[model samples]
Target: MVRNPLRAFFMMLGIAIGIASLTAMSTIGESTRQETMRQFKNMVGNYDLINIEPGASATRGMPSLTTVEPTLKFGDSDAIVEQVSGVKQVADVQNAFDLNVKYRDRTTAAAVYGITANWLEMHSYFIDFGSVLTDEDVASVARVAVIGPDIQNDLFEREDPIGKQIRIGGVPFLVKGVLVTRGAGPGGSSLDGIVFIPVTTASKRLFNRDYLTTITVELIEPLNPEPVLQEITAVLRERHGIIPPGEDDFGFVNPRAAAEQVAEVDSALTRILTGISVIATIIGGTVIMSLMLIAVSERRREIGVRRAMGATREDIMHQFLIEAAAASLVGGVVGTLLGVGGGVIAVLQQSMPPLIVWKSIGLAVVLSIIVGLIFGLQPAWKAANTDPIEALRS
Candidate 1:
């Protein structure tokens, strides 16, 4: 390497780029997968939670926007709590979107949901300050409201939002609490840009509807939700007077089903990244092999000198192979550092949580070594087979 610095550097560069690209891809992919799982956990609260909504849509990504009369209702929530054997909690939601929300001099359009008091607990949300809605707030059709962190920042600035009145849909609502920051939910939608009001108040005053948009159920044992799901389906079917042969008007977002969907997407992404990494490493190895063959030709006289001094063919082969392997091994080390830096930059650009998968770095090193051995063999063999008498003449 010292004798031919430029050649060694160029050979190392090829491997460096290949390993770096592979490591960066794997790191970014792992981070994205973790972030996706976390977002789903936030939306669903627990693995045992089931989100049920009325609609005929084939997709479970979002609840169907069905009419109030034929869809889920507040009554379904009561029935689910009473009839389901292993039920733990039922949270009913009635939401109206893109509403004109106002507080003194600030105004913004946001989503609003009328929710039962236990909705916060079921969804794993906590108040940063003040208090969450109580049963009394839902029962008396109180005009109290809880706002998310984004709403807090936009409306109140440094002023305290607690005890302050905000108007939703032209009706006065007292701000009871401010929710902690929740960055995004499904589909990258903002979660902190919503407001929560009492379910009764939402039905009677704001939207003037007695139907529910969704019912989120938390069960006692989450390991197997089959029996609970069946019970829920049976109860709703009976209440709606639907026959078994006909398609039901409602759909369910089962935790296991949603998890499978997430895993599928993650798997597809991993395959694409892994394919790219393999291609890069192969190209890098090919470059190294080509360079080594050229080096062998230039150093033929050196090999002859060693052979003339009693160096065996095996010795020549081992020297060249070891040199090639060393280049790739060093490159792998440098690439690991570069890859981590690249991944951090990418994640920072998107404001995602930072995480490093050390396994990817180890894999890069191991794979690079393998590439060195595979591609270096042919050049080493050719160097070893050279005749000492012919080489000295050259």
Candidate 2:
């Protein structure tokens, strides 16, 4: 390193870049994965839950067009809850978006959902105060509303919301329930800026559409979702008059399964990137090996003097190998620090939570060192085999 700083710097630069790319890719992938998983759990999703929406496309990440006629309905939720085996609970949800909500002189735009009486159980949510929707409320299409905690802060302003009259979409609704505080749901949005009403009331008063936007199903204990999936598919197909060869116009969104699949794909991509990094490391090693070979050729006199002082062939090989490994090792450390630091900053600047992965760091350093050893061997061998007398003559 003292005699050939420039060559060592070039060699280290290559290895450092390789390590940095590898680490940065892994870190970014994992940070996104973690955020996705957190959002999945925060929303109306869990391993036992299944979401039924209108779509038949097999593609991922592409938005599917909704049919002119809706497919999933409130009756589907009833059938799933009553007839389907291995089913625990079911909720039918119909959404009215960006509607005006009013209480006394205060008015704000909020989303209103017409959900079943079992909406709380479906979302694992509890009532902070007041009462949840009842079967009677659904049957009679009662104008009762359950406000999330944020609505409480906004409209109620610490006053008791229960028994208060609020206008949702210009329809009068009594504040029957108040939901507990839920900070953030999927996509990093607060759950509080929403109102919940009975599906019948929503159908009669709000959207006036008989079809549901979503059907949420929660399965019984220890049951695999596959059987339930088949059962529900069969039911939906029969109801919708679809034959075996035809596909249903509804799609299933299983968050847990999707999250797992996402993780699998991310792992595969990371492996590919890691392989590319390894190749880069090997190229760096090749450069170092070539430089060492040139150094041996140019320092023939020095080698001869060392040989005269009783330095063995093995000693010469060890010295050259150590120098190559040291360069790569230093590169590895610098790259790890830079890569991790960059990832943290990028995630934070984007308003995402940062996650540090120690395994990637360790892997980068270890791979770099291994690359140095494997590629350094040939040069070390040639230097070791050099004849002292021939080198002195040259």
Candidate 3:
């Protein structure tokens, strides 16, 4: 039979497009999964921190009256830490209400955290300059502050901010240190856009409130967080003089639990994308089969001439099958190259590093061969069974 290079080239193009699309989709899906996991790890931190808030319980199984009231005081943090076991450290944080800060003349909206000296060790935070607030500052209610990277950049503008005084809520507080950048949280909270001051100073001078908004507790080891969490709950309940089996007005978060939830979401996303890739491959195979059938019908005279020239039925079938396979193989190779190039372009455009999984490339090549064999069978058989005498007359 005569070989048609043009027909084979077009057939290969179709297969190549399908494979390339699948490869691009898979690479993006996998990268998204990895980035999400990285974000989750950063958001939860390395320790368990319980958030205490006010709530009401149902009376007689009916909804009771609920009021927005404060439930925890600034002093309760130390009380709980002293009473509870397995707690390595506790830091009470109180955000200033309307912290209008000013540096020389410029001003920006910022969150002011009243934290203890142990805040650094409790939350895996490090100082980029100078030193953190110490117990001496907290005890003496000293007017010293530590600012985040964003705050430092906005306030000082390339100047060494340490030892300089910044006015917070009309009160002058000396800059003691600058915190290393912590990037952004999952909720878009800017970790490096806030300011830190002594808890005692903030409570007395800034907000004048005895209640703390949140308390962060760190454990000696992350592996045994459940026991530490339980102990914290028990101590808080006892401190508040709650009766047996009563619900406490607090919430606890475990990093391990958050990581597990993220894994479930990642798995679901993978399955959905994989299904879409499979559908695309099936459509490509159908197109190849249709094109092969048309080729067989158009080459009827060529088939007859080969048979008349002593070419066996098996030989005729083998020749056509090989042509179909060759078309698909060529298409698969081109598709793989295009897919890799597209993946690299996407990463560079998005400011991400490019990654190519060799296993995915191998899988695409194998699938292309299987698609050719399955779709080319009927067309090859039809050509092999053609009548030589009828073909010669035509």
Tell me how many clashing residue pairs each candidate has. Answer: 0, 0, 0
Residue pair clashes in candidate 3 = none
Candidate 1 residue 116 Cα shift, in angstroms, is 1.1
Q: What is the TM-score of each predicted model, taking all chains together?
A: 0.91, 0.86, 0.81
**Candidate 2, run of 10 with poorest lDDT:** 57-66
Which lDDT values do the candidates have, in the order given? 0.85, 0.80, 0.75
Error of 3 at 3 (Å): 4.1
Model 1: lowest-lDDT 10 consecutive positions: 57-66
Report how far off residue 108 is in candidate 3 (Å). Answer: 1.7
Q: How does model 3 fare in lDDT?
A: 0.75
Clashing pairs in 2: none
- Runs of candidate 3 with Cα error greater than 4 angstroms are 1-6, 40-69, 96-98, 184-190, 241-246, 259-267, 300-322, 380-394
Better of 2 and 3 by TM-score: 2
Q: Candidate 1, TM-score vs. the true structure?
A: 0.91
Residue-by-residue lDDT tens digits, candidate 1, 1-394: 6689898888788888888888888778887888888777766666667888777643444444555344887889899999999899999899988898999989988899999999887778899999999999999999999999889888999999999999998999999999998877766777889899999999999999868888989989867777888898899989888896877777787765786689679868976987887798888899889999999999899999999999999999999899888988888788878988898789778778767888888999998888887888898998999998889999
